[model samples]
Target: MSEGASFRTYFEVEGEDRSRLGAQVGEQRRRVAARLAEIRNVVAVMSGKGGVGKSYLTAALALGLARRLTRGVGVVDADLKSPTVARLLGAAGPLALSPEGVRPALGNENIRVISTDFLLADGRPLRWREPEHERFVWRGALEAGVLREFLADVAWGPLELLVIDLPPGADGVADVAELAPSLKGAVSVTLPTDESYQSVRRAMASAQDAGIRLLGVIENMSGYRCPSCGSTEPLFPGSAGSRLAEDFGVPLLAQVPFSAGAVEVPSGLLDRFLETLA
Candidate 1:
């Protein structure tokens, strides 16, 4: 046989062991469920669309919750294609692996974190808008595989809360629900515009259809806060969060004012938002 034919035949032999591959995948899923069980609460922070500071809010929520919990909080950057939790929270350390499992890196306030970013190019942190981050283009089954590995392998020990930062849309949410059915719920984040409202409504519907509870909605960048004068200003014409919440029967958890500073979420806003969960 030619080289190409020989290569194909080699893979054909491997494909014959379908049962073995299936068994291995099944066992991996079980391990993932077992690992996630140790965490007290698993909540996915998501948005119907991107560019609404969902990832930043996720990190901030983890930090806030870590302060309240004795065991500390963790964040799984489930945005497989563009993992940012590690970079955002400065948890971009080399992931340690032992016979036990993959060890998550700790960020500020003793909050543990794990992400595909840590495994990139020897754990070098990816700067925002880096060309390297754009190189990855995963689809379909590949997304599911990477997500499963994160849950099954990461050794997150005794976490009070595991906040998963999911990429925009229903696929990411569905993947988490499938792997960890015990998820506490999802906190939808969105902006204060009609455009954002429509997307968030779909997100709420998707979660409900999947039998996942919609905890609440947080309106980020709802208004601008003047740092110099401590005055609040509405950046947009109006907020649709109230109507959206009413339609879904979920509360509008908090209207986090916009910040001109580096962080997307204001300090006080994060604290008040977490209180709603209590």
Candidate 2:
């Protein structure tokens, strides 16, 4: 077989077949090295629980950093099971694949996105049997050298920052700690509620155990401004984000208020976030 064909066949296998494992490992390393050369910073956006607006924050940060960062920005939807970045960006559909890769990332403005949602047929559910099932999928992709090719060979041009939108809870955090060691730090997102704050604290500790730096915390759904009375109401109450940041020696970067408009991704807010980074 030709070199190109041989490389293609390496990843086109099923299950944990350890036959060509050595070759796969070497290829993965090379891919990781190439990806590291181009992408300067990798930051994971994580939350301890669901309904805390983690995905929205990831989109905001990516769009924000993309506008400010010199090289460019990309968002990797590491939340494989519930990938929604593509839909939020209005790029949900069949994606074109090339010899360059399997599925191409959809681009908007300066941001490029990759997600499992792009792989599935319309409305297909990613129902993994066990909790380890998703992790196994991720591991298989990484081991088969698909992830390296996805990250390194993809046409992500000149990225200064790569934002990873992780799955909710500690599983995603554990995966990042194990596989993607090049991540600069993690940006934890949480609501103003005490329960949400406590969950975020646990996540922080998990990341710390993995030796990942806590870049900062972002409080979402924080306060709503009453247009009539000109007063701010605490939507969820308690300033737990501030307390956690102080306790962990990390910055409480921003407290984003809930907007009453249609729940489309806020390009204006993203622009403002970029400006702040600038």
Candidate 3:
């Protein structure tokens, strides 16, 4: 009973069709490798829970990096079921695909964008009215399959950075690592609430357990300023970002204030954060 023969025999004994699926999986992995080879750096922008503006932060980072690089940057909306990269960046429809590979749409800042939104039946931007629960309903295997395709099939070309906006949780961590082994680490986002801090702590634990480096923490919507009184009020007072940084042994990158401005990227906060990265 050699190891190779035993492996095959075990699958046969279980009456599972292993060869066909194994070949497909192997090909998908190869495709992922080919695409990742062209990208220099990969970052998984993640959080413990939703509504912390993780996707927006990922977009801002991508745009900022694009502005500094001649080759531009790439962002894959890895939240397959609830993708918002296309809508957040206002990227248009009609994905360009050829024998070479699938082309990611260009955003306002010239950053290349890829999301499951482009793969919808009509290939149009996801509507705000549509409930996310209605769009994405799948188990872990299907979710991994979609992510694998995003990495393998998308024609990212040459990119300074490939910022992946992972969904809120640790389930997809393995898929991201397996698909893109060159991933540098994760940038965890959180709010100023106690709940957010706990969630972020769990996210950090997951990343560390997977051997992924913690780039730093970004505290978004930390405070707001009153126009009439000129008084600054902390939105989530006593933000745990600093404590998280200290406990996790990672830097506190930025505490971005909330703003209603229409700017795609907050220049001041983003600039400061980029400096730390340098």
Which one is best on lDDT? 1
What tens-digit string does per-residue lDDT give for candidate 2 at 119-181? Answer: 766778764434665596565555334344546666666678878788788656656545556
* Model 3 stretches astray by more than 4 angstroms: 1-20, 121-138, 227-231, 264-278
lDDT of 1 by residue, 216-264 (tens): 7888887888999989989876586776778888877777788755444
Query: What are the lDDT scores of the predictions, listed in order?
Result: 0.78, 0.71, 0.77
Q: Return the lDDT, model 1, position 22.
A: 71
Error of 2 at 206 (Å): 0.6
Which runs of model 2 end up more than 4 angstroms from their true locations? Answer: 1-23, 127-153, 227-231, 262-278
Residue 193 CA error for candidate 2 (Å)?
1.3
Displacement of the residue 15 alpha carbon in candidate 1, Å: 20
lDDT, candidate 3, equals 0.77
**Per-residue lDDT for 1-278 in model 3, tens only?**
76665354554566545567777777778888888989878888888889988887887777767777787788889987678877777776689978878888988787788888776755465343434574555445566777887788888888878889998886566569877788888888889888889988987897788888888888888788566775768787667678788879987877767766543465465555555455
Q: List the residue pairs that clash in candidate 1.
A: none
RMSD of 1: 6.6
TM-score of each: 0.82, 0.76, 0.83
lDDT of 1 at 199: 90
